[model samples]
Target: MRVRLVEGASLPSYADGIRQVYADVFSEPPWNEDPSAGDRYVERLAADAARPGFTAALALGEGAVGGFATQGTVGFATAWTTPDVFPSGRSYGHVAEALGPDRVEGWLCGALEVDELAVSPDARGAGLGAALLSAVTEAAPDGRCWLLTSVHAEATLRFYRRAGWHQVPVSVPGRAGLVVLLGPGHPAARP
Candidate 1:
């Protein structure tokens, strides 16, 4: 697989492939998201990619798009602070508590927030996901990175654990499904 970075404005060309991979992957097991959700997600991707510090990594298999991961240092802050951008204030509130609201942005301000990582079913077990993850997060300032995923995805959790991601303990009532993880050497991991 060939992995490379695609920046803002240039991202739309690959939106369809990335959307297909996203729709397929998230539609399985723990997520089960609908096609319309995927459509909406794709529609928003271009705008999201246009954010300051946005970056995307594409993994191609035999010249065809097979997997992708995206990140934007500034976009995360926008999504977190802007109302309705994420559709769930409850989840962000939980995350803020876990990361310490006052210190959260200080820690993550320039850190890459891995927005999406998806690999086509056909490319599973090929290490494309890991490669893509590594590429996108490596682009972060100071190599600090974080992402959120379904706590119920055992296989997905295992993959991330094997990749050396450290899960942050979040003990919020009613917050059972989502998880936050920090990559190795993140500043927050220091203490």
Candidate 2:
């Protein structure tokens, strides 16, 4: 698989691939996201692409168009700086409420927050997800990067763990627990 970085200026060309990967991955099992969720994400991607520090990693197959690979690889990852003034919309509020101001600021603010990562079911188990993750975060300021996933997603949790993300031990209060993970090289990561 060939992983390439797509800056905000180039995100549109890959929107369809990103949307498809997202829907394919999230609409199953733990996420069980509705079809409309993918539509919402594509819409959100527009605004998100304009954000400072926004970056996307697209893992493409040979001859793939816009990156929805027909050559047996399709995956992507998106990330951006955690804004100094984090928004309260979406699940950010839940994250803020769960971790509180101190942890939020100390651990998250200014870090590269991975917004989404997904690989087509046919393309998983081949290190594409990890490569896309690294491609998006390899240049994180001070090696500070982070992401979150549902506690119910054991497989997702394991994937991040294997990639060396350190899960914050605290449980996020909600219908489902949200687990925060610090990147491998994060200064605060525990041994």
Candidate 3:
């Protein structure tokens, strides 16, 4: 499998695939919700793709999208970023606070805030998820990275933990049931 940053019109193509994954992955209990949520999420992804600081990765096999990851910086100015795109006003404040004032100052300098990651069900355990992560991590502008996942997603939590992401102690307000994950220190900002 080859993993790389997609550019041009192809970005939207991959975004579409990611939207499918979002629908499928969150179709069950815990993160599962109304179809409008997934639709809104995809819309946000499209907007993020057009953002200046955003970065995305795609995994391909036989020339087809196998998995994908999308990340970007989070701060005061862009704190209202994701919701405008995806419209998940429900957990917006929780995520914004987690990725906001506290962590954004130093830890998230140029940080790659993982907005979404999804692997095809047929491709699970094939390292595609890890590959998608590696692509995002390696491409992160500041070396620092972070994400939020439901504690209910035990497997996903384990995956991130094994990938070297550390858990933050704070609980997301609306997403009180979830756990936050952060990556290593900022590349340029580190002494």
Candidate 4:
């Protein structure tokens, strides 16, 4: 499998693949109830990738798109100050809090907040997701990387835990518990 960075404008090309991945991975309450949510999620992701300081990566195998990961700068100031550009909804509030004000500055030096990571159903268990995430983690500035995941996603939670992310004492409304994962070499400092 090959993993590489992709542009916002190119996101549309993988819409179907992403949707398939979402459907297969999130086919339960909260996520399943909202059918259109998948499309909206992708749309928001594409828009977020278009913003400054945002980047996206895609993984391909056997001549087909298999997975994707997105990352961007995050912090209290960025959330509270730039809601228009990147809304801080209840779900993302925990992310903003985890990043805090101190880490926002580090963002200029390589700190990045992972926005999304998904692998097509056909690609799961093939290490594509991990490879895509590792690609983003390695590309982050200052080796700082962070992300949030639903607490109810046992499989996803397990995957992240195995990937080195620790449980954070933060929760999102209407979803599940959230956690943040940092790169191995990131300086140990409060967000």
**Strongest candidate by lDDT:** 2
Model 2 is weakest, by summed lDDT over 10 consecutive residues, at 64-73
**lDDT string, candidate 1, 55-146, tens digits:** 67777656322343433211111111122222235366667666665546665555667777777776667677787888777656665777
Clashing pairs in 4: 110-141
- Candidates in order have lDDT scores of 0.65, 0.85, 0.59, 0.56
What digit string (tens of lDDT, one per residue) describes model 3 on residues 47-79?
A: 666764566777665533335332321100011
Local distance difference test, candidate 1 = 0.65
Candidate 3 achieves a global lDDT of: 0.59
Candidate whose TM-score is highest: 2
| Per-candidate clashes, comma-separated | 0, 0, 3, 1
Q: Give the clashing pairs for model 2.
A: none
- Candidate 4, which segments miss by more than 4 Å at Cα? 28-33, 63-87, 95-110, 169-175, 189-191
lDDT of 2 at 51: 82
lDDT of 4 by residue, 38-73 (tens): 677666666676665666667655543334332221
Better of 1 and 3 by TM-score: 1
TM match of model 3 to true structure: 0.71
CA deviation > 4 Å runs, candidate 2: 63-73
Clashing pairs in 1: none
